[model samples]
Target: MSFEDKESPIEVDVQSLDEPIDIKAEKKLIHKFDYRLVPFFCVSYFFSSLDRSNIGNAKVAGMATDLNMTDAQFSNIASVLYATYIPFMVPGVWFMRRFARPKYYLGTMIIAWSLVTIFTIFVKSYGAMIVVRLLIGLCEGSYLSCMSVIATDYYFPHELARRSAYYFVASSFSGSFGGLIATGITAIKSGKLESWKYLYLIEGLLSLAAGIWVFIFFPDSPHVLTVTETEKKIQADRDRRKAVYMGDTKFSKPELWSALDWRLAVSIVIQFCQDICLYGFSTFLPVILKSGLGFNKMEAQYLTVPIYFLAGGLYLVQAEISDRLRKRGPVLMFGTSIAIIGYIILLAVKSSAVKYFACYLICFTLYLGTGLNEIWLASNTAPAFKRGTSISLNLSLGNVAGAVSPQVYRDAPDYTLGHAFTLGCLVVCLFAVALQSWGYKQKNKLHQEILESGVDNRTKSRKHGDDDPSFKFLT
Candidate 1:
């Protein structure tokens, strides 16, 4: 029985020292953490998401025509961002894991991407667009990974879903907010810059502000912020119970390999399935509405506002349900089912207004795939490096869809292939969820039996983090 820290391995009976923790004060401290951390991260993510997706709005605002680009070249612009993004995630998470303070790293990356967003104003050709998007992708690749690390470090398993949802809700809000901003930008008559250029400039500045705020204010650890000895003890106890090696920067080979568990493997497949639709539908929705659905450009720009808001609102409800039930499978399946119906209507129906209605149905699965799947993975995985690797691998592999998505939707006007492809992905995701749910339940039951039989001392020693009999996976 060992808590695998390279610097100093620990073995302790957690129940023996649990009597001194004050439940009420612990609650107060957790509440304080929630307010101080969640809001700032949410706002930061809002800008990150806005910068990431606003290219869609810019495309409809005439970026392609202004750059003299063909449809194929423009589709490449949508995808080239992931060229660097996918490769950088694992290293980024490794950096965060080894660093004592990840806030500075995270903040600096945000600022870097924000600057790239501002630089999009100078993109006068297809190659320039690709360069800017590539730079942005490099800078933003690890943001969500860093945030996932921070969340796992600070919160309990049960709390991860709701907190993860908060960041994603901000992500969801960014789409709507950016749409509103783009709509307003279209109102300006100034010849100095195109409406698309203005979208980049304004959102970049906003994101820069958030980056600075996080750099200046985000805490390195709960211990650094807690004032009282009782609060500090509570933090220590919390970490002990979580089996996290607080402040330890050493990486373990075992934990790294443990990250390749079957659960993570299955989760990655599900992530790939969902992200195909998430990246495809989200980045292309504006174009889909304008080019395929026959809406005017301005109409396409603003219509995304309400649809994204619908996504955010529904995610909040789903997050609440997930936290309450302590289950990820049901909510995920439900979202996919509804989105399946949405894609059906989009493909089967001929009416423009009815197709518009189908977009709302598709929005139901938005956060479930990206945010909720992240929560499931983060909550289930354990030990700092292991969790970090699991998350990074899931994201890096899953987001290859960012590149694939643009190609699928190239058919335009009808986009029958794109709609059918995404629908098939949803069906795959449905079965994956069932398989993962069954796996978690079986593992939980096995752990329970091991704990009851007292055959292994790992529970008392808290060995192997989440693999210990005492630790239960969040299904």
Candidate 2:
């Protein structure tokens, strides 16, 4: 069979391999895709984040008291939401990629969680809260990881980080926005429901609207559509920069058996470390400032706005630079280094002014390691199943931190132990990143030797993804 006949359903059309440049057309297509899709992803992710972290907003707005939750029970409320997150990551990606278009599946999932967020208004007890949280997890599973894959369809590999940064920024914006909304929501004295319930009802309605918008308007990737000659050429050309691994439509037993290994474990560790930093900061920062640093409730809420803005802004700058340099390792190292410094300041400093600055530093680097790391793994892996599996594994394992980090607040007030623990996770993550970079260099050398032996194996190896000598590693 010819290569085109055997390629995965989602891959770039082999027919376009030799197509001449169409700089103007490519730019138009990209801008069109960005205009059409990025906003949907941005808004969807913003709602996802607002709902996910709004509990932090709600907790401070008095959900705990309204529901009679103890500190431990409150922590459990945070943790229980991820009860299904880990188990569903891989399957979620696999299922969405196989059966659902990116737009429809994600829109549906967002609406599901938005409704779950609304259900929080009815929680009069801790048991009710736990059930609601667990249901939320089932709705949210693998959405972020799937977003990573969908981005590859819309952007070239080098462009993925900047686009991903937008989604990341939406989350940061959501954090800050959540705080602002909570500040207002808490000031209300005349509401029928509690202040926190208002926070949910409003955010939930907006989220549901965004979901419906995407479901109505989001289009399938152009590569998958061939209704017209002009459209096919435009899309096929766009694929010049698209990820070569579009993934298979479904999983097979052999692919599954061969995909798991130590590298996947390491990727998961890297993800786990990043999430410790993410959930550690995103989930608890406002509360930490209030309880530990002694800011008044509203004072703490408004203060979070600038911190999240700074972080989101900083990530956009970093994403642009990473895409320009095309260097994942250096960016990952630099980001982690900055984050490590932030943790150190939080650990060692006596000045609250400097400590607040350190919080910005942590939020700033939140997207650095994890966002680029997703691009890094996606660029290197191939044969859609392996890529999906590895990304899902990394996300699923890493997200356990989202559940666990909230409870680490056991060291409340000072929170010295929690910060230290997160610091340690980042350090390990950096080491893992370095090892992968080094391993890439070594593998490239071996591929070089094989090429020099006069074996024409490049085309034969496309089925192996990055393992193909024709495919070079980003490292």
Candidate 3:
């Protein structure tokens, strides 16, 4: 029989093995797996990333010259964008929890940012650019958090890391594609029309189109999709099984607040530090290659593509491994440590070829952190309302480092201080990962004690008499 026709496998009584089963429910639950969810999330993330990182490509092309700004001033403009992001993330996420569907929340932000990005092309001065960038950040701040919450709602905890990797790989590819597209557009210049301006306009328009598509085609949740009634029944059953496995039908406010404890705080801190390293590389790597390594602008842009592609591939591989292992701390630690090593090579190597190779290492290490960190936060949080808020807080707080990092790169020919700062940030991330790992172990031990004592698992409670003893961790 198909998954939809199979009875639900969840035994309601934790202690009863002799009771007759509800085979129909089991089938419904198995059949409810909506495979379309992944593609929707991937597409949403792709446009979100394209709009944000297109600025990097624009900066290299002619954004600085057109706006008549100094390097410091340009860096400050970039910083301002992220500044708004820090304060707005919590509020944005809270709004998503209280008022709007994820589809609506995420779609609106995409449309708004796209419009703002398009307006960027028409700005005549540095001040206007800064204002627009900040506004864009305010609009775009909630998309990542919303996506994280949505991912958890659909996938089991064990499956989240790999799913997150798919989302982030879209983001990584957008970064590389943005560069290539920017390079191509900038290569063609008309009288009075700057390539950077055209670059922003084109990307912004694409984002607008994507937003419209998502608004129409995306389902708010698996239960509301266009699937058959049989499929919907299956999906509901699966959710029930997941609820039992987690020990709760749905998250309560108190549970959410409790989940946002010290562990959540530490994850945010690690994300913040890691962002310092990541944004620094993403935003300024092209500039460094062109100016420091003596490559032309186009060559530098093209060269960065391979690094990003490899990084995206590595994110999926690492996330899969982490999921298989059912652990978050070790995965994060390993990823961060690799980032540190990459930065060391960048700092120590004098040869041009060696430095280029180090760029690949940096890409691998930095992007690897995305999947581990996103899954880590999602796994630890309860589903629904609190999950959305927690994700927003973590992402918004972590991204504040994005604002700080651009300022680290002074106008000097070599961005030595920026590289040094990134290295230091990676070290802090290493420590944070260790702390989180320890905390997870403690939480797991306590949970085991509770199980042994006949207390319900903090997640979903098993039916009173079911004897299945398997305790799954959200990796």
- The CA lDDT of each predicted structure is 0.81, 0.76, 0.71
The global Cα lDDT (0 to 1) of model 2 is 0.76
Q: Rate residue 334 of model 3 by lDDT.
A: 77
Please write out the lDDT profile of model 2 over residues 1-475, one tens digit for every residue.
0001112222244456686656676667667667777887788888887887777778888888888888788778888888886788778777777677777888889888888877777877889888988888898887888777666556666666788888888888998899899889878888679898999889988888888888778766645543457656867655433334343435656556545765567667888898888887877877788877778888878899998888889888988888788777778888898899999999998777888889977865686667778777766666556666777777888889988887786676778888999999999988988887887778677677777885654553434555655556666
Q: On a 0 to 1 TM-score scale, where does candidate 1 land against the true structure?
A: 0.93
TM-scores of all models? 0.93, 0.91, 0.87
**What lDDT tens digits, residue by residue, belong to model 3 across residues 130-172?**
8898898888776777677666666666667787888788888
Clashing pairs in 2: 247-384
lDDT string, candidate 1, 353-389, tens digits: 9999999998889877878888788777666667778
Best by TM-score: 1
Preferred candidate (TM-score higher): 1 or 2 = 1
